[model samples]
Target: MVTSKVKQIHDFGQSIWLDFIDRKIIFSGELKKLIEEDGLRGVTSNPAIFEKAISSSSDYDEDIAQLSKSDKTNEEIFFSIAVEDIKLACDLLAPVYNEEGVVGADGYVSLEVSPFLALDTQATIKQARELWRQVGKENVMIKIPGTESGLIAFETAISEGINVNVTLLFSLDRYKAVAEAYISGLEKRAADGLPVDHISSVASFFLSRIDILVDPFLDQKGLGDLRGQVAIASAKTAYQIYKRMFSTDRWKKLAEKGAVPQRLLWASTSSKDPAFKDTRYIEALIGPDTVNTIPMETLQAFRDHGDPASRLEEDIDGAAGILERIKVAGIDMDAVATQLEEEGIDKFSKPFQQLLDAIERQK
Candidate 1:
């Protein structure tokens, strides 16, 4: 009876959150088993995940059919069902959530605002707040993209005490900006005599996708040896940024008011290429005050044969060197970040519209 590898990860301080969710697991008690057996701490959902769940299965048909009979718009209908699923997930995760006047605790179920709102600051803020109010669950986190406009809404949402999981982050510079926005929001709230305790956030960095975009370029540059290495090195570098940002006098002041530092969460963690180990991302990035939100396949792969360790802070100087060499190779990392951000929005928006179209077919 060896300890489960996924459960063993908790000993090193990294929480394994399921990145995929469908009503099937929630209602079937499979989700609960993951919590109990695998030590799963939280869940994350996106439009693409929901799109696959709803369109590929009959689990959502009755709900969609009933909602269609009403005068509600397709978007309205989708959220109605999405909210119910989120609430269910929140309830399941509530036990692990510590809300005793504490901030930045885990066990949250995240729901994203519309991906289409990523570029519209005001609309992103409006939808984020609306979704926050609609779900009305303390353990539920509303995910906003980390785009330029999304960062504006993120700061505002944090100030308003809405827990946010900032998604689609790519560059180190943008990650720092996201951290600044979180701190600025808490600072504003504390200045206004509002309670800063209990607000939670995680700056999610899309990992494997970084390599997916950069590998071919590396190949052409005769730097194919660096194919799977860049994403891990970038993440290690980002973890260093996290440590520095949260150790400042400014962040310390907020901590005194019970504000918890936003943690760095690894997203898009599943390996896309079969040439890499299934647990390539997870094995390299395990550290405290961090999370790795993995898809079900990766989750199962880890539970079966993954090795758990605290390696995120390893090879610090080497990590920096990897990034520097990539720059010297004439790769514009900033340009790559911008392209990934735009593509990430479209990745979600297309599936979102498809989900809406599927609901329209119900009529």
Candidate 2:
């Protein structure tokens, strides 16, 4: 029997997606079990996760060797391997897709466009189109960063009726921007006589990273107890933006045409600060039309002993107060958001290049 904690999360209307992906999880049937047992609805992947998978496992060695002999560049080889994994995952989750009506179980697998192209709107769009085609799965979402250029690519991709997973959003402003991009894309698709109902998108707002970056500043300024406060506060405010955006006349028009609300996704929920509760992020951000993509350790922790409850809606006024407190503590959140955005790109870019280097070494 699934634990009441896990079941309650689903009952509360939030989707729990596994943030990490590997061949072992996929081929060994572990991923399927998570879907069946834990209500795991989706999978998200990036260069960092893929780097660990390919470098740490022997699963991709033969494919890497064969591709090295071809004229394909290291980046191409990497994407090819990632696409294979995505295709396998998409197939595995197909039943859930069929049963859940596109928004539920077996929702989609996300493969990010090259982090190198995060700033190039045209290139990001080009690469996203190629990735969607290469994966060849109806349930595939091309992950685009929420950078300015990426936002543009996101708009174009949605306009072209391609599914998108907008990643790295750290602020309400950024999340709203991404939502607008999704809506704009849907409007464009609707105008062009495309099926707006089929185009899907999610704005991924990372959690623990916010706390990781802000808590220390809070501590140095005699606000150490504020550790783990910024992330939830930021997310709650972001959901308010989500609620307001989707309720607008513009989005209502698109919704009438079958456009799904670009749901807010909580990413990086694994607790980085050992001082905090293991399930801190997950338990706090529980709300409707949202997703919490937990890493394996966090997932198991929640499954084992988590006291899951419907806490997301319990503290709306308090959540707002938390943000105000942070600002009063002299932490400029707009500056923090800017820093996080820059660091997010660099963080992914390093691992992406590392994956390329690892592939080259294998060759």
Candidate 3:
């Protein structure tokens, strides 16, 4: 029997996705069980997750050995392995996909374009298309950072009918830009007489990292009590923006053309501050047409003691108040968002390069 809380979360219209992926989970049928038991609807991955998966496991040994023997570069080998795992995941979720139309509870796996290409619009688009072809799965989403150049690449990628997972967004402005890009892409596809219904996308707005970064600043400024507030406030405001943008006439036209709204996905949701409640991010951000991709720890935390009430809807007034208080406390949110964007890029680039280096060492 599904827990009432979990069912309530689904009833509230939010999708829970696992943020981490590993061969053990996939091969052991654990991922399939999550779908069957926990109502898990999707999966997401990044370089850091991939690095840990490849470096810490012997499960990929045979594949790595075979690729090493083929004289392929480490990067090439990495993509090959990642794509293989994603294909397996896609297959595992295929039944769910068929049951619920294209918008169902499964068959979604995200593969990121190189973090090194985050700033190269043209190159990012090129690589995104290439990765799409390489993965060869309809349920796969090409993950792109929500950088300026990434925004351009996002527009082009969606125009070509590539499903996207726009990652690393930390601000309302960035979210709006991503939504616009999705709309533009769908508009172009419709104009070209392409089927827009098959294309889907999600804008990933990172949650816990905001508190991890801003809470320190708030503490140093004598506001430590505000430790867990910024992230939720930020997400609440982002949802407001999403509502506004998708309700506009422009988006309605694209909607008429069968364009799906780029749903808001919460990432980096694992609690970074041990002092905070483990399900703080997950519980606070629940709403309709949204997704929370939880790390294993967070997922377990929610399963254990989470109160999945309609808290996201219950505290709209307070959520707005918190943001007002944050600004009044002299926090430059835009600056912090920009810093997070740079740091977000750096975070992924380092892990991605490390994954490549680890593959090279294996070779």
Who wins the lDDT comparison?
1
Cα-lDDT of candidate 1: 0.94
Q: For residue 285, what is the lDDT in candidate 3?
A: 86
User: 173, model 2: CA deviation in Å?
Assistant: 1.0
Query: How do the residues 40-150 of candidate 2 rate in per-residue lDDT, one tens digit apiece?
Result: 888999889999999998999999999999999999999999999999999887776677455433468899999999889999999999999999998888999999889
Per-model TM-score versus the true fold: 0.98, 0.96, 0.96
Please report, in order, the local distance difference test score of every candidate based on alpha carbons.
Answer: 0.94, 0.87, 0.86
Error of 3 at 138 (Å): 1.1
Candidate 1 to truth, TM: 0.98
* Best candidate, TM-score: 1
Candidate 3 scores a C-alpha RMSD against the true structure in Å of 1.6
Colliding residue pairs in candidate 2: none
For residues 120-155, could you state the per-residue lDDT of candidate 3 as single tens digits?
Answer: 999999999999999898889999999999999999
lDDT: the better of candidates 1 and 3: 1
Better of 1 and 2 by lDDT: 1
By TM-score: ranked, best first: 1, 2, 3
Give candidate 1 regions above 4 Å deviation. 99-104
Worst 10 residues of 3 by lDDT: 98-107
